[model samples]
Target: MKYLIPLLFAASPVLADAPVVENITYSDGRFDVTLSHGDTGWDDYADGWRVELADGTVLGTRVLAHPHVNEQPFTRSSQIMVPDGVTQVFIRASDNVGGWADDTVPFSPN
Candidate 1:
C-alpha cells in the first residue's frame, strides 16, 4: 500500500541526532546558551531554540540560520524580559528533523 511505504520511511533514521545543551548562563534579564553535538555531526541540520517561563510560557525563540559545518561549538545569546517575581526559566532546542532538548535555570530578578 502507498501508506506502507511512507510509514516505513518515516520510521527509518535519516538525519543526525539533535544537539545538546552544553551550558547555560543567566544574568540581568538576559541569558546565554551553548549547544554541541553529542558524538554525532549535526552540521547539515537546521534548528530553532526557545526560552520559557516557569509556568510553561514562552519567552522567546531563535531560529538558527546557518549550518554548523565545523566541530567548533555553537553559542547563542538572547535578551529576554523575565516576569517580575519569577525565579526560574526553561529553555528548549528543537531541530527541523524532529528532535528536541530542554533545560531549566534558576534566577532572581533583583
Candidate 2:
C-alpha cells in the first residue's frame, strides 16, 4: 500500500486539466465561445484557445492573459474569417503543461 500511494502521487501531474466548452455561438464570421476549466495557476492553466479547420489549419487564436482561477468557466470571443469553402471548424483549448485539450468543439459555420 505504501508503494501505491507514491505511484498515484507521481501520476497526478500527468493527469493534466483540460478546458471544456460550455457554449458556442457563430455569426458574421465571428465565434463566441464559452469554456470551463480547472485553472490552477499560470504554471498549469488554460492559456489560450484557437479556431481550426477540419484539415487542422489554424484560423485564429485567442491568447488568455492570466489564469481563470476564480472563474470556473469563462467566455471569450474571436473574430476570424474562415475560408470560403470551409463549412466547419474546431474550437480547441490549450493549457500550459498539457498543451491542447482533447475536447475539440465542432463548430458549424451557419
Deviating ranges (above 4 Å) for candidate 1: 1-15, 38-46, 99-110
In model 1, pairs of residues that clash are none
Which model scores highest in TM-score?
2
Number of clashes in model 1?
Answer: 0
lDDT of 1 at 10: 92
lDDT for 5 in candidate 2 is: 90
Candidate 1 residue lDDT tens string, 27-67: 77677777665433354453667778777788887777665
Per-model TM-score, in order, reads 0.68, 0.83
Q: Which ranges of candidate 2 are over 4 A from the true structure?
A: 1-12
What's model 1's TM-score? 0.68
Candidate lDDT scores, in order, read: 0.67, 0.84
How would you encode candidate 2's per-residue C-alpha lDDT over 1-110 as one tens digit per residue? 87999888888867676888788898887788888888888777788899988778899998888888898789888898887777789999888888888769898886
